[model samples]
Target: MPFVWAPIPFPDTNRIDMALTDKRRNWTPEEDVVLLTQVAADLPFAADKGQVTKSWQSLADKLVACDHFDRVVDGRKVQNMFTALVDEHRKFDMASAKLSGVDQEELEKHTLLDELLPLLDEVKS
Candidate 1:
């Protein structure tokens, strides 16, 4: 998908809450009015395969993700990206901790065994 900046709330209104796509959420007509009014031009991208195109939607998505495009973009995309990054970092930390139990000597032994599986298999038999 092209870059995007969701949409921001109007000057007199609070921020718009972006609901999950699967969720049955509703937006008021007033909110929609504010969203359309504040949305900038050329924020979408048309598919040109190898060629790169820019539009209001793409810019909007990006702005939303960065929190800088607050006026015309949703902030959820940024939140999701951050959440994913945090999850990946946590998983990496867990995996590294689990690997700590395997000493260098044992790792080397396993590496050699893994490399000579056919010969190691013969010996095992």
Candidate 2:
């Protein structure tokens, strides 16, 4: 006898709110570089109290105006993405610090991250 598979019925009324919301897409490397550059350029605005949202919205608008991406994003989305990037950078920086005798050449490879480091430090202070 062959085994039979049955499809489960999903009710429309019980649908999750997430399904109705916009689907998230992954940011490309180019997009990441562009975002980081934009953020670094506007670090002062970002550090200013109560101007973070406006800064992010400005970044989003700049990104959209670049005519590189097909999908549109809002300030919140850009902020979240920047947060994730910063988190990753923190983790990587911490790990690198733990390692002994890392070559200067290797460390210098992450030029973009290095450039943003001073801006981030300034923001913290």
Candidate 3:
């Protein structure tokens, strides 16, 4: 079941019972860049052979095995994070793809600009 973050108000008294807060381990910006970069890089080599690519769960297992944090996240959360990164990659890919035919050099520049700029912007923020 999903977690509840709201508090329960008392009937008459000025007291309320707040649900215990869930303390999840937070990922750092450096870690985010590392993991996302890994995922993106893996995409190209994934189709190297006619064999099927590994699933997100497999990637999750690899991450968990190598992660330095004390918090142990399950495959599900890792899969979700991977999915979001893939979505962001798709967004960047689409931005570049939109300008594919105007000029070759311009397309390459636009693709590179859109790809790295947003990531830098996000990292700074």
Candidate 4:
């Protein structure tokens, strides 16, 4: 089920508190794919403009549109998730690069995260 952000009513008050009532859930693999795809699409724009938050917000909107995630995702959440993914991929890429006999053509990337490495490298250059 998708997470809903309902306002909590204050007792005897006319105000409603707009805080997240449920704990945040982990990103699913499907959601990650959506996010990565969206990021890849926006890479050139982001590289030229350097507006990461706007790019992340666009990614969040695209992910939410996919309706694959359990909870509502915001730009900040998307940014954090992408940051974590990039960090993990960096470590993985470094370890893989250090391997002596592994040919680039022989390396297999079965996940969206793995596929994102080269695109990220492009943005850096």
Candidate number of the best TM-score? 2
| Candidate 4 segments whose C-alpha is farther than 4 A from its true place | 1-22, 44-47, 97-111
lDDT of 4 at 47: 45
Candidate 3 lDDT, tens digit per residue, 5-122? 9988658432323222223446654455555554554442243343323444555556667655333455566556555655666685677678866554434323433465465456
Q: Name the lDDT of candidate 1.
A: 0.38
Residues 27-72 of candidate 1: C-alpha lDDT, one tens digit per residue: 4334333333322222122224333233334544655464322333
Query: What Cα-based lDDT does every candidate model obtain?
Result: 0.38, 0.71, 0.51, 0.66
Q: Which residues of candidate 3, in runs, are more than 4 Å off?
A: 1-23, 44-54, 67-71, 86-125
Model 2 residue 118 distance off true place after TM-score fit, in angstroms: 2.5
Per-model TM-score, in order, reads 0.24, 0.66, 0.38, 0.59
Better of 2 and 4 by lDDT: 2
Q: What's model 2's overall lDDT?
A: 0.71
RMSD of each: 21.7, 7.7, 13.0, 10.5
Query: What is the TM-score of candidate 4?
Result: 0.59
Mind giving the per-residue lDDT tens digits that candidate 4 earns over 1-125? 99999999657432323233334446666666666777666662344475767767776777777756555788888778777878977787788879878765422222666666677777667
Model 2 agreement with the true structure over 1-125: per-residue lDDT tens digits = 99899998887753555455435557777777777777777763345688878878887888788776544777888788777887787888788889869764543225667777777777677
